[model samples]
Target chain A: MTEGSSVPQRCWQIDSSRKGAEIIRITDADGKSLIRVKPGVSAVIISSASFLEVILEEGARLELLRPFLLDQTLEREVSLSVHQAKDSSLTAFMVTKGSISFKDNVSVVLAGEGAEVSLNGLHDLSNACEAHSLTLIDHVAPSTKSDQLYKSVVRDRGHSFFHGKIMVRREAQLTNAYQLNKNLILSPEGRVDTKPQLEIFADDVKCSHGAAIGQLDDDQLFYFQTRGIGREEAARMLVKGFVKDVLLKINDPLLRAEAGGML
Target chain B: MLNIKDLYASVEGNQILKGLNLSVKAGQVHAIMGPNGSGKSTLSKVITGHPQYVADSGLVDFEINGQMVNILGMEPDQRAREGIFLAFQYPVELPGVPTSEFLRASYNSVCRHHGLEQMDPIDFDGFIREKMKVLEMDDKYIDRAVNVDFSGGEKKRNEILQMAVLNPRLAVLDETDSGLDVDSMKIVAHGVNLLRSKRNAMIVITHYQRLLNYIKPDIVHVLYQGRIIKTGGPELALKVEDQGYDWLIKS
Candidate 1:
C-alpha cells in the first residue's frame, strides 16, 4: 500500500498501444495525482474520484483526454464522500472529437463541509458523424457545492446528445449547484437533444439548471454575409464560437488546441 | 453616379416595383417620397439584390470613370463590393456578432476591392471611434452586438456608422430618419452631410419630408403607382408634406 500524506505522483497519459485500457486506484487523504489519456484510449475509475470519506490531500487533480474519432469509448464511475475535508478540487476534460461516445456517472457525498467539485465536458463533433455524452452529478451532503457545464456544436448532419442531472438531498443545506447545457445546430438536418434536470429536496439550497438548443441566428448570418463573408465561412465562425466556452475551461492546453483543430 | 431603368420585381408572386426608373449624379442628394404600399421598400431591396425580391426584368448600373456597369446580376454582397451601400430602414439585430468585427469586415472588403491596403486592428478601431463621434454614439457600442437590443434612435445611428466606415460611391438611405427624435435626426443628417463628397452620390428614401429639412436634397421624386410620376427640386418634398400622397391616387 502506498502511504504518504504529501507525495506527488508523476502525471500519466494512458498507454494507447493496447486496444483497451482500464485504471482502478484509490486516492488517500492529502495525496495528489495527475492522469491524462490520449485518443484511441479508454479509462474507467472504480475508486473514490475525489475528496470524500477519503481525505484528498489538498489540490488533488485528475485529467482525462479522449481524442477524435478513434473507434474508442470512455466510461467513468467515480464517487466522492468527503466528511470534513476542506479545499479539495477535481478537474476533468472528456474531449470527444470526430466520431466518439462518452458515458460518465459521478456521485459526490458532502458529509464534509466546504467541499467543491467542478466538471467541464466538451464534445467537438463535425462532418457527417455523431458524438454522445451523458453526465450525472449528485449532492448528498450539506454545505457542499458542484457545477457542471457542457457545450457542443453539430455541423453538417452531425448529431450530439447531452443529458445532465443534478440532485440535492434533504440534508444538503446551503448547497449551491448549477448545470447548463447549450448546443448549436448548424445544418437543417443536424440534431441535438439536451435535457438538464434538477431535483432539490433541501429547503435552504440554491440550485438552477437550463438547456438551450437552437440553430445559428439567421439575422446574424445575414449581417456577416452583407459584410463580405460568404454563407459557409460565417456558419463556421459561429459554430466555432459556440464550442469555445467549453474548450477554454479545460486545464490542459494541448487538449484544448487539439479540440479546436477538430472543429 | 447611379441609374435604375425599367425595373420590375415582386415578392412571393406579389409585384411591388413595376417598371420603375430613377437616376442620380455625383455631388447630388435625391429624396424619394412615396406612400407606405407604393413599392418604396421593394425598390430599396431590389436595388441591393435581396434574395427574396425576384427581379423579372430591369437594369441597375453604377457609372465608374464615365463607364456604366450593369449590377442587376450581382448579389447583395457583390453589390456592396461594387460601391453600393444600403442603410436598411429596419436594421437587423444580430445578437452574437460583435459590432466592431462586422464594421472591420465591411471596411476591409471595400478597401480590398478598390486595391487599398487592409487596415490593421489598431487603425480599424480608431477609424470607427472617429466616425462614432460624428453620430454622437458612445464608445461602449464598439463591443456590443450589431443592433442587438438597441433603441430605435441607436439603430439609425448604427446604420450611419456603417455608412461612414464603408464610404460607398452611391449610398441608398432607406428611411434613415424614421423613428428618430429631432435630435437624433439632426445627428444622422450631420453624419450624412459629412460623407457627401463630390465624387459620391446619395438616394434618401422616406415617407415624410422632415428628413429633407436637415439634409436638403437637390431633387425630389414623388413615387406613386410603382413609378416616379413627378420630379422637382427640394420644394417638391414640402409640397407633398403639406398636400400628402393622396393626390397621387388621382394623377
Candidate 2:
C-alpha cells in the first residue's frame, strides 16, 4: 500500500518479479496515481487472485496503462475498481496480446459532481487464445461525463468478447455518455462478440452506443495493388490503418509505436 | 507504344466492351470522347487488368524497352510496375496511411522492378516536394492520409501528382477533368503537359471538350458502344462539343 499527499511525476510500476495477489489504496485529497503494468506480469501470478482498487479524492486524477503480452500456458484473471470524487478525472489505456485464457473486469464510479472518465483499450489475439473484458461505468451525481472506445483484432482461432455498461441514476441529471466498440476479424475462424449497453433514468441526459464487426475492405486492398504494392504488404498497411485511431489516443510516442508494431 | 486488337470484355456477366480496337503511338496524345455508358472507362480498366473486368478476348500489347509483352495475363500491380498508369476518375481514400509513406512504397516497388536503387527517406521527401510544386499542391497534403477528406479538385490534383512521380510509359486519364473549376483544371492540365514526352503515350478519356482545350490532343476518336466509331484530327473534338453525342449516336 502507498499513501501520499501528492503524486510523483513518474508512473508507479508493479513489480513483475513478484508473485501472488496484491492491493493498493490511495485516499488523500488531491492525490494522483499513474499505474503501469507491462507485459509478462501475469507470469508471477501463481495464485488465482490478483486485484487493484484505487480511490481518488476531490479534484484528483488517475492514469493507468496495462499492456499485456501473451503467455502460452498461463491463465490470468484481474479485477480493477476506481472511485472518483468531485471534479476528479480518470483516463485509462488497456492493451492485451496472447494468452490461453484471460479475463478482466473493470468498474468505475463517478460518485461526485463534475466527474469525468475516458477509457480506451485494444486487444490483439492470435492462435487459440481467448480474451474477455467487461466494463461498468456508473454515474451517481449530476453533471458527469464518460467516453469509451475499444477495438480488437482477432486472428486464426482466437476469440474476444467485450461488454460495456453505462448507467446513470435518477439524480444524475445533465449526464453525457458515449461508447463505441469495433472489431477486425482476419481469419475465418476468428470471432468477436461485443455489447454496449446504456441505461439512463435522467430525462435531460444524452447517451449513444455503437458496435461494428468487419474484415479488411477488399476494394481498398485492390486500390493499393493498383499502385504497385503487393497484396501481403497492402493487407499489413490496412490492418495498421484500422487500429491507428485507437493507438493515437496514447500520448506517449514510444508506447504508441510499440502498440502499432503488435498489430 | 501500345496496341489493342479486337478486344472483348465483360463485368459480372454483363458485356461492356465488344471488339474494341485502337492504337496509340509514342509522343502522341489521343482523346476518347463518348456519352455515358459508352465503355470509355471500361477500356482503361481492361488495359490495367482490373480484377472485376474480365477480358474475354483481346490482344493487348505494350512495347517496353524494345520488348513487346502481352499484358492480358499480368496482375494489376505487375502492369503498374511495367510502366502503365491510370488516373482514376474517383480516387479511393486510405484513412490512416500517410501520403508520403504510400508514395514511397509505390516508388520503391517500381524501382525494385527496374533494378534501380531505392530512395532514402530524406531524398524521397525532397523528390516528392519538387513534384508537388508541379501540381501547385500545398506542403501539408504529404503529411495527411492518402486522399482522405480531400476536396474534389484536390483529389484530381493528387492524381496528377502521382503521375508526375511514377513517370509511366503509357498513361490513361479516365475523366480526370470531370469535376474541377477553371483554376484547378488549368493546374491539372499544366501538370499533365509537363510530364508529356516523346517516349510516353497518353490516352485521355472524356465526355466534354473542356479538358481538350487545355491539353491539346493529336488525335481524337469518338467511342460509342465499346468501339471507336470515328477517328480524326484535333478538329473532331470541336465538332462533338458544338453538337452532342446524339448526332454521333444516330450516325
Candidate 3:
C-alpha cells in the first residue's frame, strides 16, 4: 500500500460483536466497487448510492441498509447487483427520503441451491420530490427463494414509481418467489405508479406478485377520532402505521424507532 | 348527563332521525329497542357526532364540567374528550396500530383532556394488563393489531375492554350482542356490568332482550320512526320480546 496514493482502501474488517457495522459512503472518485462476502460470516453494511457488485459466498449472510436521504436538492441514479451462492441469505432495506429525484435499480441472482433473499424498500416523499425504483430477482438454481416488499407514502405534489420483476429458470424446480408493492397517496395531488411482473419457466416453482396503490381508510380515521384523537394526529398515526411494518425490517431497534418518526 | 330533544338528522339527503327525543340521567340505564330502519343506529351516530350523520335541527346536550353544553356543536374528538363513548358494532381493523399503543393513546388522550399525567408505555403495559382481567381476555390481544383478524366475540370483548379502560361518562353499546354466542355474551355482559357506576351512565341498544337478561336496564324505550313511542320498566323489553313491535307501532 502506498501512503501518498489517492486510492481508497478496500480492506474488509469484522467487528468484535460478530455483527459488522459499517458506513460505506459513495464519492465521485470511487464510483464502483466489488464486495465478496466470506463464507459463514454475517455483516450489516449501511451505504449510500454507488455502483455496487456483491457476491455472497456459500452460507454467508448480509444485511444492507441503503438510505438515500438528502438535505440539499439533488438528483441521482443508483445501481446495485448481487449474486448468491449455496445456502447464503441476504436482506436489504432501501429507503428513499424526500428529494428532487432518486432513481434506484437493484438486481439479484440466486445461482446456487438453498439460497434465499428478502428485500424491502420504503419511499416517503413530499414537496414535489420524485422517486423511481426498478428491482429484479432471478432464481437460477433449484430450491432458491426470494421475497420482496416495497412501499411508498406520498403527500403534497410528490410522485412515486415502482417496477418489480422476478424470473424463475427451468432448472429452478421447487423455487419460491413472492413480490408485493403497496403505495399510499395522502393528497389529491400526490400520485403513485406500480407494476409487478413474474416470469416462471419451471413447472414446480411457486411464484406470486401483486401491487396496490391507494389512500388511507376513512373508517380507520374515524375510529381514531372516536377514541379522542384529533384528525391531524389520527392521520399521522395512520401514515406511520402504513410504513411501520416495512421499516421494522431494519434490524437495528434504535434506528428503526428513529425512522418511524421520519417519512 | 345527556339530553336530546326534537333531534332531526339526515344522511345523503335521506332523513334518518326525525324529531327523536330522549333524556338520560346521570345514574340511569336506558335500553332502546326497535326494528330495522327505525333510527336506533342513527341516534347513536348523532350523539357521537359522526360527520355523515347531519343533525338538521334540534339539540343534543351533555353536562360537561357541570355546564349543559350542546355537544352537536363540538368536534367528534371534543365530544369524546367530554366523556362520550360508542362501542362500534363493526370495529374497524387497524393493520399496523398495535392494540397496546392504541389503548395508551386513547387513555392518555382522555387524561390529557382532564389535566392528568400520561403514563408511558411501560407503566401502561401493566395498567392495561390489569384491566384485561375484567374481560377475561388473553394478554396476547394487547400485542396484535386492533381488531384485525379478531373474531366477533373477541372484537366485542376488546370494545368492552376499551370501555373499561377509558371509563367514560356515557357509553352506547350499539347492537353489541348481535353476533355473540351465549357464553361470549355472558362474558361481554359481565365486563359491561362491571363498568356500571352511578357517576357514569349506559345506553344499551339491542334488537333482542337476551343481552338485557345479563345487564338489565332501568328503563326501556321503544323507538319507532325516529321517536320514542313507548317508555316502560324492564317488562317492556319482555313484552317486546313476546309480541314484537307490531302492537307498539300501532298504539
Candidate maximizing TM-score: 3
* TM-score for all models, in order of appearance: 0.78, 0.88, 0.93
Q: Write the per-residue lDDT of candidate 2 for residues B162-233, one digit (tens) a residue.
A: 888899888999999988998999999999999899999999999899999998999999999888888999
Which pairs, if any, clash in model 3? none
Judge the docking of candidate 3 as incorrect, acceptable, medium or high. Answer: medium
lDDT of 1 by residue, A1-263 (tens): 12453444434344445334333344342233444434324433323232222233333333333333334354322222222234445444555555444344434444345556666666666665665565655566677788777777676777777777778888888989988888877678788887777888989998988888888776566556556666676676666656666766765565557556655
Q: What is the TM-score of chain A alone in each candidate?
A: 0.67, 0.79, 0.88
Cα RMSD, model 3: 3.6
Candidate 2 per-residue lDDT over residues A43-136, each given as its tens digit: 1111112355555666655455565666648777766677777887776667788847788788888898998888887888889878888999
Off by over 4 Å in 1: A1-121, A143-147, A204-206, A240-263, B64-66
Contacts from the true interface found in each model, as a fraction, amount to: 0.29, 0.59, 0.64
Please list the residue runs of candidate 3 whose C-alpha ends up more than 4 Å from where it truly belongs after superposition.
Answer: A1-30, A250-263
Which scores higher on lDDT, 2 or 3?
3
Which stretches in model 2 have alpha-carbon errors above 4 Å? A1-50
